[model samples]
Target chain A: MKKRDIILVAAVLILAGGIWLITRVFFNDSGGQLRITVDNEIYGTYDLKQDQEIQIGTTNTCEIKGGKVTMIQADCPDHICMHSAAIDKDGGTIVCMPNRVFLEIVGQEDGGVDTIAQ
Target chain B: MKNKIAFLGLFAALAIILGYVESLLPVFIGIPGIKLGLTNLVIVFILYLYSWKEALLISVVRILAIGFLFGNLYSILFSLAGGVLSLFVMYFMRKIPGFSVLGVSVAGGVTHNIGQLFVAAFVVTNFKLMYYLPVLLVSGVVTGLLIGMVSGEIWKHVGAYIRKNNREKL
Candidate 1:
């Protein structure tokens, strides 16, 4: 094996491991989602009902109906979120990576206002 | 050249299909642009089958076709960066005379992801996005290994056939 082989393997392993670890930290449910940012905006006590619509980030749009929020449209290049269906239940999350928006349903953890940005 | 082009076209089709199929597969991990990269097998196959230029062409065709068909416009740049980086690594590995294409593939995949990450870090106005690089790299390793192993087996079959056919012609 060339020294390049060793270097490449080590580099990939270390970086991938770190990203995986951070993903776990961000996505893993603990107590509840402390913050929810849709397009980097901090909305307070986001109340939702059936058929309520909201735009996520700049590209994607979302709606809530029957106490569930679903992505309606995404101008994002991938439209992965637009392809992703709605979330009507608790503990559901939506991510638009290109738009850099993350939407989450924070359950009755503290049951009050909280800072929703990292 | 026509026969060679025909063979290349076939491989390109295979790579495109693999790329699309992989998109539908559930994320082994949740990070975007991070996946098993099942199609790199085609790249590895090309690396073994012909010259570096041929392999590089396959990589370009496959990445562009899949990106245009299934992904957004920005994907083009990222794919280009990754493909170029991968071929560079593969070219070096090929210099070792009898270097295993599988090993070359592993290097390619990892370096491709690295290239993508580097571009993301530099291109994006917000530097915080670099945070995602760690995960993309990790996924690259596993996927690279998978493509490597499969391509290694495939190379055996393709190599034997090519040798046999060439000898008959000679």
Candidate 2:
């Protein structure tokens, strides 16, 4: 590897590290709302504080209890959705690839970040 | 012309086979979207031994064929985004005088992840997915390094043969 090669690799690693540090420092989860989508369309948004079971188009079922959401049941073959850990934090995401379903926790404070970044 | 077309077909097929073999192995990492990117070996090899056009053609054809055969529609979209972005980055990086094949591959790997994440964000409509960027960056470097090293070795032996055959045909 040449000097420029080293420099380029270093630059990427440093940039990645910087992003990670920024996110970690600002990371805050205060019982955010859970947003779910299916096939790239909005399915529903549920309050994390509320306890309810969501049946997502017969493909998967998500249960929210004690301010945490988890995929309790899914018809997808891999069951990777069900295996994902419960999410209650500001940016935690659970995705069901087979069904094209996605779930993530969005805090009120960070809502503007998405729009601004876009 | 015939030799170039045959070489393209052979490389495309090799890429598809590598992709299929990778899919067969169960992912031990819990993180989604992480893979060995074994098919990239073929892409890197082509980029060094041939032109970017040939490499790009092989990458696109392999992704489309493999996606239809072994993956879903969503997968096709993701792979298209990642593969094209990676190829673009590698192509330009190879032009830089000081960049080695390893550097080009690492850049490709990193951009590939960024491209896939962009698609994920768009599909999920969630920008918070950026949180996964750091992990992906590290994985991209590690996997890219390995793939580049392997590709370099393969190119050392096979590259001359391909070039010689093309010249002979001409």
Cand. 2 TM to true fold: 0.70
Highest-DockQ candidate: 2
lDDT of 2 by residue, A1-118 (tens): 6787678778888988999999887764334799999999999999887899999998899999988899999998999989998887546899999999999887654433232222
**lDDT of each residue in B20-89, candidate 2, tens digit only:** 9998977627556788899999999988877788888998899899989988777788888999999999
lDDT of each: 0.69, 0.84
Residue runs of model 1 more than 4 Å from their true location after superposition: A1-118, B97-99, B167-170
How far does residue B114 in candidate 2 sit from its true spot (Å)?
Answer: 0.7
Question: What DockQ does model 2 achieve?
Answer: 0.27
Model 2, chain A: how large is the TM-score?
0.65
For residues A27-104, what per-residue lDDT tens digits would candidate 1 score against the true structure? 433333223475578643355433457764456677766666666787778877666766543456778788776777
* Candidate 1 residue B59 C-alpha distance from true site, Å: 1.9
Report the Cα lDDT for candidate 2.
0.84
